[model samples]
Target: MNKLLKYLLATILAVSFINCTDNFEDINTDPNGISNQSLTQMNNHIGGSFTPMFLNVFNVTPAWNYQLQQGLLGDVYSGYMTPPTPFAGNVNNMTYALVDGWNGFPWSDAYGSVMPFVLDIKNAVELGNDPSGDKFVYLANIIKVSAMHRVSDIYGPIRYTKFDDFTTTGEYDSQETAYNAFFNDLGAAIDGLKSFESDSQFVPFDMSSLGGDIAMWRKYANSLRLRLAMRVVNVNPTLAKTQGEKSLSSDAGLLETQDMYINTGFAHPITVISGSWGDVRMGAEMESILEGFGDGREEKYFNPASDPALNGVFKGIRMGIEIEAKGQYGNHSSIGSVIDGETMQWMTAAEVHFLMAEAALRGWSGAGNVKAHYEAGIRTSFSQHSVSGVDAYLLDNTSTPKDFVDAINPINNIAYPSDVKIAYNNTGTNEEQLEQIITQKWIAMFPDGQEAWSEFRRTGYPRIYPVMINNSGGTIDTNIQIRRINFVSNEINTNSTNVNTAISYLNGPDNGGTRLWWDIPGSNF
Candidate 1:
């Protein structure tokens, strides 16, 4: 493990230096540093590159990296969890202060840890001229899309499509352009891997739950295509239908009974962040929705609050509230055993079902019976957590999200902003049915707050609580809420020209107030 870590760090440093220069070809071809020959023994040149990409997707080690990567942004914004510790004297991401120092993790982590490895894999495969190596490139592409899409969602424009081109390394692609490129790459990967479906070349290199199954990797790619397809349905329904239908009809199939998780070989970061550091706790919105619906997954997701005043109840802190100290909310419910394992979750079968349910709602082809898919989603999630009462839970119609009550601060209390229920509303309006599907999807995708937050911003379902504090200096609205994070300081400092060009692609300013391409503000219908 120590040897592998040293190698990964050395490779990353080499790649980082090559990537920083104006001419990648000049630096890469110079061959002064770790060369392909050095890594060729035992296929380490190609196989080893997969490790960093898998690890960085959720970043397992040094827990604080994971905290900055997603915990502070997606976890809180998605209403999944809130930090008890008030960093920067309470003026931070939670309050929409737009922390440049903190918000750069998602970008830096992706580019530094994930992207370079992907490029290396592609180069190694091409230079080797082995047809068998194409499978490695395909697998790397799948992982690249999975990791880079999250980065694109965070910041509206990202350095993708032309990342390997030295002349345009710093140029940014608009969110729309990036999504199109993602679809193209996923399509190529899905098609390219079909002939190699039975191949086991990936077994020794596989770190995911799929266990080196190429067919399963194809299924994951198809499912991810479906996910990205649905993300743009509102803005580009025709294109959405085309790609969504392709995913539905693909022989590669979608993730039905299986989930995609990367075995990071380390403790889940949330455990350390919530349990050891006492920095994170369940979000108030989570408490409102889960408790209001009488959700059986509550115990599976969070532990009872440690605060003696709460008396073992599942309590959560409201985000963006005035917190002078951590003790006020430090005893709030911490993450439970769900994330106690070593793997970092990527996608679930339950989430795939919900995506199909949404596809059905959109009247896309190959999406049979909306209610069936919706119910299947709920059942799959219940089974995943080993929770019971799924039958009665499916019949729930009277329950709605409960209003939140701040245990320590009454001023932080707020009403949950929805009346949506658990039962599949077959006869309800399109918008109402979407709310039901997205709300359930949001619940089932526990702890994967990046996707949850993106869906929340895209659909406006499962109405999350707005921040009580507004610290964006009026850049971000307290009501409409934050849309996307601003471009990182690293980019502005190093690639100011491209960063300015990227800002023009945004719907508004470059701050958190700006909406991305797919975040259309209107009814679901």
Candidate 2:
């Protein structure tokens, strides 16, 4: 096949999943064909592409629309919510189920769907010169690391042996190898910084909105490497520490992604462009944590007006007690709530700052003000969510947070205000850092429902109400949150061997109660 033919074929398979309900027998003809377009045009489409991808994958669609954020329903976050009452068996517990076998979701959409064009962009970059190629490479690395981290986090391992393969006999690789490849990609990305020396070539890469900016992409790559390394600390400490240290040692400038998140409006999912509607909202687990902190972002993330009150409210349902109707979508008075994609975000400066703060806390030596990063995270979180500052917020509090600072007890009192630095002085050990992190992350993840769930599951700090109604699986602990989402129905049929093997590692049926590799313990009633 000719070069054009190969690109065309690859493009076909890529869009095949875009979904066409009608006679789409052969309609996948590269709606955004980049091979014929220049590097600039290609980057245009990719510039803000990640916003929808991240929001969609996490299940943070507009709840008013009934669109589900895949990860939202996952047992990680809102699994705490039940049926006619709140959380039910139908909810997804991603850590256990969504990552492996057959449930790996649209989270990897960036990896499989958006990434292929990166290869084409590379060709375009090579065809051009100066900032074009360099900027593309850097952005490619940023996207690459982001996607790989998602894959590694879920499956624990993947086939990175021969990436972007179109041939036979190329199977999946181990997670460790995938991490190594991630490091290599980071190195390549870091090298793109020099490409910015020639003044950004806006012709082939117009980052004025998002892409033409290579310098920012470089920081994103480094920071992302830090995140991936930190993530693998348990699985590969030596590698994690080394990579963390390496990224820290570098002078590859650090810019928060929040400074430039995807604020796309009137686009598909959010708009009628794709002719699609999505609804994802703040999970009860998340809302509880934020409310506890009196987080300012909750106003942005959650609707202040009670849609359920207007309509009928469906709280929680029994998991497996054989219940009939869980509840209706909008059983309250009205039929609408805001689930539109108007508020979607990709990466944010706040996230970058938070990651830096985490790196500082973990002692990942790098060019950053750990305290400033910490404060940045807090302030940016407020700014991101349009939250009020600490003072005004505290005034709204019934009592100063400082009053309760020393009153609470954590699993690790040492990790409290003393060692964590950020926790120091502001609120003594009793302040609940777990809630703080989740509260901030929840805001930063505006329109990102799934990530909110992930943070909630990893910490298990917030106490939550079981459910207004229950579903069929079983009862969720009033205190202990749900563990994992059940393996999807399809996996049991196709990848039964791996599915069964994975189940053996799980405590129960790999349902909402099963835990993932990283989650801490919880009461699975």
Least well predicted 10-residue stretch by lDDT in candidate 2? 403-412
- Expressed as tens digits, the lDDT of each residue in 139-181 for candidate 2 is 6556656655554444443434465566621344444566788
On TM-score, the leading prediction is 1
Off by over 4 Å in 2: 1-104, 107-112, 122-135, 168-170, 197-199, 202-211, 263-282, 307-343, 366-372, 394-435, 461-525
Candidate 2 accuracy as lDDT: 0.45
Evaluate model 1: give its lDDT: 0.90
Candidate 1, position 305, lDDT? 94
What TM-score, to 2 decimals, does candidate 2 have?
0.64
Residues forming the 10-long window of minimal summed lDDT in candidate 1: 17-26
Clashing pairs in 1: none
lDDT per residue as tens, model 1, 1-525? 764565465456545534543553444454576554555544665786888788898888889999999999999999999998989999999999978998999998999889988888888778778888999999999999999999999998999999998898899999999999999999999999999988887887788999999999999999999999999988998889999999999999999899899877788999999988999999988999999999999999999998888999999888899999998889999999899878889999999999999999888889988999999999999999999999999999899999998897798878887899998888999999999999999999999999999999999977888899999999998988889999999889999999999999999888999899999999877
Q: Judge candidate 2 at residue 157 and give its lDDT.
A: 39
RMSD of each: 3.5, 9.2
